[model samples]
Target: MCHTSGVSSERAAHLLRLSALFQAAPAADVQALAELARLRTLRRGDVLFHQGDAATHLYVVESGWLKVSKLAAHGQREVVLHLSGPRQMVSGVSVFVDNARYSASAAALEDAGVLTLSAEAVRHQTAQSPALAQAVIAHFAKRHVELLERFDDLLFSDLNARLARLLLEHAPPGTTLLLPTNSELAAHLNTVPELVSRKLGEFYRQGFISLERRTVRIVDEAALRSLGGP
Candidate 1:
């Protein structure tokens, strides 16, 4: 199980310095915002929220991981998004829009520490502070752009490319890949378990990747990229 630790004073201070999301806010305002947030812990596989459920708060992870996914009609799950490690916020877009129902569900991938701020509270604070308002707007804009990029990938990319990109993006730096269950990897890549299994076998035989139980290591990134084709 992944363990989540409370935000240390140094980390909290560092988060306030982030420029993209809260650039317009002054350092003092950022610090105040941090203070207003409440921290919570989550364990791996724990559901943070469910689809169609009321969206009340935005969460910022202090540590660990979360997967944001949607459930299909056939009882299949698709991972639509991933979230921050330390000092990164999750589901900011949904909360900022004042949407009552969540578009997706979030589950802890590991033990995670998060700070949650009620939408009402955030709105109130932003109302009195122009900096906070700018921050929220930036957050919304970023999420919109990210979703558009994902849409492009879904429309134009093949399954192998999609899976490779997901692995490279989420895996630890310098790590070739992670061996996740076919179902889990399929969900993230927007594919089916059977197809994923077949592709994995093909890649393994081609010397593009090495598979051990549930762990996958990329042996040839160039070869994997070739499978995506130009």
Candidate 2:
């Protein structure tokens, strides 16, 4: 059972501030959408939805992190998706598709908050706003393109190269990068933690990088680039 009573007028107004979902929606449509949503908070390690569970609602993260993963045939869980930080839309594609069950399970990486809108409510709002419908379609299309790129990277790039690229892209603009834990880094890079740690050690020995706990400092950016090939 989920709670929906904490969403006051202020919180409801803040929910309407989600630009991604209601970018082109009219004021009335935004209000209606917000009204139809239920707010829920999740603690770290909480399972928001399990694989094959009915996908009744789409989620928007207001804060914290969520990881979407699926169990492989080998009895290991593989993280295929991640939503870190705020204002992320979760599992929106499944709402319009024929599949009712969740394709992957979503778990809280940290204490998080989310607003969930029923599939029927989303459909009703989209039906009333053509712009919203088009926006949603475009959002899904962009996500598909991103997934294709990830597939290409995994197929063609080596583990070290992939890890380097991920670090550069996600790292803040600074001299040192605060990398995730080895376990979390493994999931993000689609590999095992032991392998990731080994690669980091190799990089350190080669004088190309330095690792301190979860922080990774790129000592030689040029060498890092060379590992990724031309």
Candidate 3:
């Protein structure tokens, strides 16, 4: 179940700090932006917005996880773009560009807190604050570069290499990563679930990784790094 709620000053400011859009701004500015934002509680599977939906606000994940994805044409499949956790913005450039519409869809991966900033509010606040403006630009640039990297992988690399890279970058030596389900991983990798399962099994056989219920433990970082090489 989901609901909207508010928090006290200390907690609200803390939540804002988690977001890259406000992480480095002055305390006063973050507070000002927080004042204008409304808190939302998202239940697991809550659809925050859909591709082609009118761009109304920017959302920050204060807690829990959010999945960002794009549906394929003919509606036969989807490609996961991101799996965002705490302090991350469901940041899209739509609000800043012409005839704004989200290019991808986002949903709550679990119950979470989100802070929404209306486009108009941000425009006004940012007009009066250069710091906020610069932070926004930086955030946009980061997200844009990530998109470009995803494109490069999809266009130039093979599926096994992409999967290896995904696990390698996200998990460190001997660390167990809380991974998305096979299906979600497939979508993110722009492949099928069977391929993901098979490749993971191969990784296990190679002594490069170990898998359990919802977790993947890195066993050999060097081997994965080799397969994940740029």
lDDT of each: 0.69, 0.73, 0.79
User: What are the TM-scores, per candidate, against the unseen true structure?
Assistant: 0.75, 0.75, 0.82
Q: Taking the tens digit of each residue's C-alpha lDDT, what string does model 2 give over 1-230?
A: 33354565456547656646556566667777777777889887788899889888888888766777777777576665554446667877778755578888888766788888888788877887887778777767777898898888887888988876765544423555555567777877778999998998998899877778766777777877777665
Candidate numbers, best lDDT first, in rank order: 3, 2, 1
CA RMSD of all predictions: 3.8, 4.3, 2.8
User: Residue 86 in model 3: shift from native, Å?
Assistant: 1.9
Best by TM-score: 3
Residue pairs clashing, model 3: none
Error of 3 at 17 (Å): 2.8
In the range 1-230, model 1's lDDT, one tens digit per residue, is 33334555445545545534665576776776666666678887788888888888877766666777777777564665554455566766666566567888888766777777676766667788887787778767887898898888888898888776665555543553334567776766777899989988988898877777755677777775666554
Error of model 1, residue 67, in angstroms: 1.5
Q: Give lDDT tens digits, candidate 3, residues 1-230.
A: 56766666666677888777777777888887778777888888888888989888878788777889898898788888878777777854676664588999988876778878777776777788888788878877887798798899898899878988888756666555677778998888888899998999899888889888767888988887788776
Model 2 poorest ten-residue lDDT run: 169-178
